[model samples]
Target: MSFREKMLWVAFIAMIGGFGFYFLTLLTPIGQNASPDYYLGLLFFIIGLTIGSMLVATLILFIRNRSEVTFKEDERDRNIHKAATQIAYYPLLLGVWGSGALFHNGVSTSIMLNILLAVLVGAESIRLGYQIFLYRQA
Candidate 1:
């Protein structure tokens, strides 16, 4: 696979793993009664884990594919990225609007915040997945 493709895979996996764990924990009884400080700490831990993993993965991929690491994107890659981003935007917009609606309906701030985070993660996942698919098809 190309260097960019490998990086995309790494990022996608890291994001899913990190956010999946967070959401799963939130579903537990302990999470429901957790203080704001606990949630803040958990968020920091998750963000750190995700970013650190992605950086490490990128380093490994760079070492393995040093040549490709220096290669710049061409028209096809740019187009694929553009298309994926364009496609992902719809979900993001809808999610934000949905979150607003939830707020309007008197949902808790925590729930709305989590929903926003979920939307961002989901949109990113979709973008990465679409890029991978397009690269493979091409």
Candidate 2:
């Protein structure tokens, strides 16, 4: 497998783990009360861990296989990414609109932020899934 494919698998696992933690956190009393501090902290933690892990994983991959570490994407990879990103764009736009609606409706900041975070997760899931699909096809 190419490094990109392996990285996609890593990213997929990370995203799934993050989303699971998100929903799990939301089911807690903090989520019930819409505690902005707790929810936002979790969001930050997930983002940090995802980024940190990817970087670490890349470093590890490079260390393990110094010769096979190809960083450049071919045309297919670029097309797959562009298409997947285009697919994810609608959810983001809708999420922004939903966030605005929540604000206009006087919804709690916690809830609005949760929705925004959900949007991020949804977009990421789509992108990762599509990328994996394309990778599998190749």
- The Cα local distance difference test for each model comes to 0.92, 0.82
lDDT of 1 by residue, 1-138 (tens): 889999989988998899999988988999988987888799999999999999999999989999898899999899999999999999999999999998999998878888999999999999999999998999
Residues 12-91 of candidate 2 have per-residue lDDT tens digits of 88888867787787888867777567777877888898788878887887788666675688898899899889888898
Scored by lDDT, model 1 comes in at: 0.92
Please report, as a residue range, the 10-residue window in candidate 1 with the lowest summed lDDT: 31-40
Candidate 2 wrong stretches, greater than 4 Å = none
Error of 1 at 131 (Å): 0.8
Give the C-alpha miss distance for residue 64 in model 2, angstroms.
Answer: 2.8
Summed backbone clashes in each candidate are 0, 0
Instruction: Kindly report the root-mean-square deviation of model 1 from the true structure over all alpha carbons.
Output: 0.9
